[model samples]
Target: MSNRDYSMAFMDGGLGDKAKARYRKRRKALAKTVGMPYVIYGLDQGPGGGNPWDSHVPVIYQDPELLYLTGVNQLNTALLVDPITGADILFLAPHDAKKEFWEGKQLGVGTKAIEKLSKEITGFKDIRYIDDLNEAILEVLKASKKRSIGTFWHEATQGKKRVAQDSNYRFKKQLERLLAKERPSTKVVNIAPQAWDQRLVLDKEDIEDMREANHLTGYCFQDVLVAKKSLKTETDVAGYLNGQLQMRSPFGQSFPSIVAGGKNACVLHYTKNNDPLPKKGLLLLDFGLRWNHMHADISRTIPVSGIYSPLQRVLMDIVLKTQKAVQKATKPGATLDSLNTLAWDTLNGLLEKKVLAKGGLAKLEYETAPHRIGHLIGYQVHEGDPFRNYNDVALKPGMVISNEPGLYGYFELTINRHRYKEWIGIRIEDDLLITGRGCENLSIDIPKTPDEIELLMAALV
Candidate 1:
């Protein structure tokens, strides 16, 4: 394992109190419509088969005392000024010492460490046995009265599914039965969609962590550009980028690394890294470094030979121009829909000009620009938010969005000959944080200019 202490690496930046206040106002307004806002988080079960404690899974199992403290502290902060009964709030966890020995050492619950970590201002009691859960749930349900009992439900589980031979869906059935019996009057809250949408907009601590990841991501891309000569294959570049990211404080990737070379670059969500780079073609790399679950997403296209060919330059210029326009309009008040529309218009205009100037094809129209110009990047690679149906959800400070503009043109095709097919495909992406005045380009060092990129790459051995 790398020596970098990711957890202790303090991020100097944060969302600030102003952003927190804004979130408070927004959340309060939301709470009025959906009652007081007390949420129960069921700790994730640890991974089996002898894998090191996946930090992604609940660490509450490894150190019950610490996790309990975290839960208690969070609950206290939530109920700070509320008029709700102290006993109504509860932190539920399965306390099994035998299971702890099977996994790892467990910090005993109700210790001084737990108290300090939890910021013990709020009242809470921990139940050791699963048998006590039934009575505890009943008490909470009775106390809730008019206020609905709130709990988050997992929307989906990805990566490997286990099935039982005799009882199909036995795990889910048993879970539902347990929950149903625990509290008959309890109401489950569908925060999955809400969490997904809000994820794009970082909170105080989230921004602090993400900014560090963003800084690292930018610096690492510079390394990629500098060492392009050594990077002959997609896998080679992916490994290089992953090494840079992992060598830093954080030890994992935000999402699967994309290092598509040549025509493979056209594949939007490309993850296959085995392809070899053509001598003088384009390479589109989309990746991110994850820090404390917070991530910074970035994508860049570069010339394989350190200098773009005429056709490569043409496609790159158009994509760059589209991105520039999108960046210009990416203010705090703008929405993704408006940004996407602007990107389309900008790209289409450039395509039209290129066509008319060269007399390539007057009939072709650059209508839709592949994907969205900007998206929320945070906790989850694609952060969660609540505003799904609303197309005009105004942007705000503390929101980090991606400005990815792509141009895909194929050669020797019958449909649209104007689109360059042979040696083309460019996507330049960067993570930007919306500030009070306008925005801050977090991934600033990764070069976009042809001259800057060429000069930087030439310096490397």
Candidate 2:
């Protein structure tokens, strides 16, 4: 089946219609705000060099903004939106029979089958071959009264120097260079902020996609927990979880799976999953599944043994309590800063009560909770906006964020030198959908509490 047909079938009747309506509203809103002619470019090709891991493989990803507007995930596609008329034109690369012979067939432009399918799926009336992009852009800019063009532009880094890999940054620069030599009077403007603002809020279709993604992620977690006793290495557990996700969802992982075992958990963002599982240490699993371009970010740490030791249980309880408090305070009008303050207060209050020791409280707070409480979860795993440190933006309804609070006892850190001698790390994360009254835990089905985790692990033995 074609990409459009596959997406339509995946979303089905009302859901598909809702997505189309969302795209229409978004386009109209953009047209009203940025009152100028604009073009959005998708990824030209896959990332990496001509090496085996790079361009030669079939690993193309569409630009998120372009995908949001056109509902087309295929590479080498572009979208032009007329701000004054609110009309959309989709440009697709011409079909290359030779390339198709080596690779698979793609949705070719100018064909009756593709034209009908594109209109039905993307809701755009005008579709043309990408070869006409230069003429189309010039005509649109000339017709505009202001002679202005708007597109996204942001700097990208490759090693030391700023490099343009597959981003619109390079494309925008090339377009500017072309216009300078051709239409010297016309100017290019950045509309990324305006475009990103529209993507901040979650629509009904987006919420449904996230819900299903989290559901599948929770099941994968359960499968790994059930086989914890049989698992010997970190890679074994990571492979099991990834295998489950692939079997259930069409998309791959949101990011590399962090399957850190024992002391390795203290190191944040550990992606190397080759360490041996400690017979009596904690296992930290930080990973998420992506489905239909939406993502679910989740993390959970459990005992490698059937049950947590007394010290591990205490630390896990504190982290879980902090996470729950953050979730409870995540209604509308709450800021991430406020929630983080609450987390700090909860952790500090435990220290004040002499939970750990007298002087080590400050050291523990600094080392254990080094990272922020959570981040906004969406198309990107760390979806930017409103969830950054000290950002006072109020949480509104239809915003999905992650509620993750962790406590790590690093071996080298002086904080873990005394009473907590054994290397230990504990984190509890849940994807939350902010509602009018409160937040719903999208990953509620996954086992988290000490008893729940112990029970699940006991069954594995």
Candidate 3:
């Protein structure tokens, strides 16, 4: 199916309609606020090719890759407003031939996909030739009589952190040049508004995509569980999981797959994916996917063997209790502050006497806390907007979030030597969907209960 059909079908009927309605409302609101004769643009879903492996393969399906490149292909899907009334044009980058052969075929500027896009129904103004960009801007400017030209200037590029920082990237330079060139007379509005205390509530499409991603993650986790006992290296497991993501669905591994075992698992964000497999103890997997560009963050810490040792159990209990407490506390109006309060209290309640003796909650430092219980998960893994550090933003319905609370303490005797002697850590994470009443565990199928986890590991044995 085409991307549009796939997106539409994925968004269930009612929800899909709601999304369309919202898009219309957003556009109208923009028009009312900003007026017309303006331009609004957003980052495209980077380089959509046939397969993820093509990224590594030197030569494979080169045609499909080139066919999808849309440079500055502004659909003007959103309202580009100015103070004056003027014509509406969806600014798009026309297909370039030479670039297409060198790169890939040009998917006809907004021509083929504009109808699928939930934007204002209007014909597109193709700016295929970079040479025509100046003329287009001048045309708009002249029509507006240069009376404070306006276009949405979105500086926030999702997942382009590395590219944005690099001063030499072509896209970055072009955008920069546009801003510098237009600043003289035109008014450029930073379209992406930031809310300090808000958490992102999922829209219908967001929920559908996240649900699909969680489904894939749950399956991949099961595969890992079955493969754990037999595996000799962490890299093997990571590759297998990644292979599943690319082969099975439109989804791809959201971030680098982390397959740390034993002591290595304790190190959060361990992406080496090359650690030696452990014979016994925990294999903490804090990985998920970027399904259809949405995120599904999941972490499951399982015993490599079918059973956990007394020490591992103690650590697991602490982390599990903390996770359960946070899950229970997660409801509408529960702030991060309240969630953190619950996490600390639960951890304190579960801490072994030995751990408390060295330094109870009061004595422990920030490293012990290591990571927050959850964050807003969406287009970006740790999505934008809806500030997390505070608790003012109440959890709202349809908002997807991660309820991953973790505690990390190192084994090496060098960093803060007293708190943890053996250097152990535990983290239990799951994706949750906030609803009208409470929350729904999206990653419910993934084994988490002590018995269920043990049963899963037994299968591997």
Candidate with best TM-score = 2
C-alpha lDDT of candidate 1 relative to the true structure: 0.58
Candidate 2 ranges beyond 4 A from true positions: 1-21, 55-60, 110-117, 155-166, 351-354, 358-369, 385-390, 411-420
Clash tally, candidates in order: 10, 0, 9
Candidate 1, 190-275: lDDT as tens digits:
43344334444566676777778888887888888877788788889889988887777433677778888877877788888888
- Candidate 3 local lDDT, 287-361, one digit each (tens): 776554467788877776668765566567777878888887788877666787778767866664434553533
Clashes of 3: 9
Name the better of 1 and 2 by TM-score: 2
Candidate 3 lDDT at 343 equals 85
Model 1: CA > 4 A from native: 1-34, 46-83, 87-134, 153-201, 361-367, 385-391, 411-423
Candidate 2 backbone collisions, by pair: none
How many pairs of residues collide in model 2? 0
Please say which candidate is ahead in lDDT: 1 or 2. 2
Cα distance off (Å), candidate 1, residue 214: 1.4
State each model's C-alpha RMSD to the native.
7.5, 4.0, 7.4
Q: State the displacement of the C-alpha of residue 303, model 3, in Å, after optimal TM-score superposition.
A: 1.0
